[model samples]
Target: MPDSHSLRIVHCFRAPVGGIFRHVRDLIDAQVAAGHKVGIICDASSGGDFEESMLGEMRGKLELGLERIAMQRQIGPGDAVAAIRTYKIIKKSRPDVLHGHGAKGGTYARLFGSLLRASGSRVARFYSPHGGSLHFDLATLQGRFIFCVERLMERMTDRIIFVSKFEQGVYARKVGEPRCGHALIYNGLANREFEPVTPGPDAADFLFIGEMRALKGPDIFIDALTRGSAMSGRALTAVMVGDGIDRNHLIEQAQAGQMSGNIRFLMPMKAREAFRLAKVVVIPSRAEALPYIVLEALAAGRPVIASQIGGIPEILGEASPALVKPEAESLSGGMVTAINDLEGFQQLLPGTQVLRQKFSVENMAMRLEAEYFAALGR
Candidate 1:
C-alpha cells in the first residue's frame, strides 16, 4: 500500500458551511490523520457563519492549506475570473484526484477537469452535489434547461458521488445510472463529541436547528406544532435555531400562531451544544439528503421527529414507524408521538449507537479512501 504521504487530493467547494462543507472538512481531517496530503479550494467570503467556522476550524486543526477565490453571491465577470483562478490552483497543486463539491465547485471543476483529462493528465475528477441544484425537481422550462446542462457536464465526471442513496437515486433516475461510476456515501457526523450532556432543566422542550428557510420548513414546523394540542400553552417550549432571510417571517408566524412565549428563536448553535440540550430534536426539513442533525440527535440519545423525505428514512430505517410526511398534520403527529414514546425511542438508543458507528467520520474516511482508489482503478 502506498503511504498516505504519497497520496494527493484536492477538494473544491463554494463558500463554506452546511453538510457539503462538513463532509469535505471531515474528509480533509481524516486524510491528514492517515498521512495523506489534502488541499481545499474555496471562496473567501466568510461572514463567520456556521459554515465559515467549520471550514475555519479545519484550517486551524489540519496542516492542509487552502486556496481562496474572490467570489460573491451573484454571477458576473468576477466569477469567471474566480473560475480561472481555481483552474490555476488545480494545475499547480497537481493532485492525483480532484473532488468537486456543490454546484459552483462541481461545474467549475468538471469543465476544467475535462480540459485536464483531454490533455492526458493523471488527475481524476469526482463530483458530489451536496444537495445542489442538481437534485431538486425542476420540472419547469428553466429547470429542464439546468438539468440538461448538468447531464452535459456529467460526462466530464469520472465519478458521481451522492451523500445519500436517495440523492443518488434521484440523479440516476433522471440523469442515468451508476455505470458512470456512482457511489452513495452518507454524510458523516462528529459522533465523538456528541455524548449527552445532563438535560437542562430550563432548556427548550423542542429544538429546531438549521436555517429559517421555507424548504427547511420553519413555518411549516411551527404550524404543525401549533396544531398539536400537546404543544398548546406554555407547557411545551421550543427553540428555533439558525438565522436566514426568512427569520423575520418565521418569527411572525410563531407570534401569529400565539406560540411566541412557547417558541424561542435562537441564533445558530454549536452542534454538540444543540444536541446536548435538545430533548426532542425536530428536523422539519421539506427535503433532505441525510441531515447531520438527525444523526447527531440520535447519537445524543434524543428522540428525533423528522419528515419522511430523502435519505432520512435511510438513517432512521425502521426504528420510528411514526415517520410522518412533511405536512402540518403529519409532522404534528410525529412530534406528539416522539414525545409520547420518548422511552420507547430511548430504548432504541443502543441501535443509535450502532448507527452512529456506521456514520462516524472515521468509517466515512475509510470508505471514501476505498472509493477513491476504486475510481482510479488502482
Candidate 2:
C-alpha cells in the first residue's frame, strides 16, 4: 500500500516531444530522486529518433514503467480505443496521483482517474494545459467543443497546474475559471543548463529552433532572415533546427525566398548544442505556454529575440528590446537591430542570478511535490 510519504505518480501526455516532454522528464527525475515511484504514458507515433533515445534513457528510471500507445493529434473514432487501453495500463499501475500534461493526456488522466475513484482508489487527478487546445481560436467550432470538454473535465481534476500566468488567464477566459485547485509554476532549468554555451567560430548570425509548423513561425523566421538581410544591406545566415509536419513546406519556403544559400536546416538536437551553432536565438512562436527553449537559451547565455506572445514577456520582461510582435516585419526588424549591436542586445536580457533563483528545477520539483501532498490532504 502507498503511504503519504511516497506516492505512485503517473504522468500522461500525447506527444513525447518539445516542452511538454522536457517538463515531464524534469518532474520524473526530481520525483524519482525524492523517493516516489514514477511512470509515463505518451504517444507511440509522435516522436523521432531523438525522442526515442530520450525515452530509452528514461525507461530504466521509471518505477511504474513507461507505456506508449498510438495517440492521434486530432479527435477521432480511435480515441475510444486509445482511452480504454490507456485506462487499463493506468489501472495496472495503481497510481496514487494521475498527472496529465497537454490536452489528450489531461482528458485521459482526469476521466480515467475519476473512474478509478469510483472503484475505491484514492487517486488525485492533475492537469496542466501547456497551451495545447487553448491555442485554437475560441470563435471556431473546434475551439468551442474543446473548451466545453475542458470545462467538464475541471470537475474531475483535483488540481490544475498552469506553467504561466498567461496560460492561466487564457484558460479563465476561454474555458471559464477553473473550479478546482490550481497553481502557476514556471518551467525551470537544471543547474548544468545554466552554464553558458559559447558560440562556435563558424556559428551563424541567428538560430530558429522548434517545430516546423506555421504556428511555431518557421516560415516567419525564414521571411525575417530575408528581410533582415535586406535591411542590413547584406545576406544574413541562420540555422533552422527541428523536425515537424511542415518541415518540407518550410524548406520550400526558404528556397522560394532565395534563403536556401544562407539557411541551414538540421534535425532536432540538444538545445545547448544548437545554441552553440548560432550567435542569437529566435523564438517566433505565435502561441506557447512558457516554452522551455526561451529558458534554455537564456540559461545558456544566448541572446534571444522572441515574439511578445504567450508567457514570453513574463520571461524576457515586457520592456526588453528583444520582444517583438509575431510577424515577419517585426521579427526582421528585431533581427536587424541585434545584428547591428549584438552585445548591447545581449545585455538587455534578464540577469543570470534572477533566472537561477526563480527558474531552478530544484525549486520547481519541491513546489510540485508539496502541491501533490496538499491535494492528497497529507
| lDDT string, candidate 2, 158-271, tens digits | 999999999999999999988999999998888999899999999999999998888899888999999999999999999999999999988898899899999999999989
C-alpha lDDT of candidate 1 relative to the true structure: 0.75
Residue 40 local lDDT, model 1? 89
lDDT of 1 at 69: 78
Global fold similarity of model 1 (TM-score): 0.89
**Candidate 2 global CA lDDT score:** 0.93
Error (Å) of candidate 2 at residue 72 is 0.6
TM values, all candidates: 0.89, 0.98
Note the residue pairs that clash in candidate 2.
Answer: none
Stretches off by above 4 angstroms in model 2 are 1-4
lDDT of 1 at 364: 79
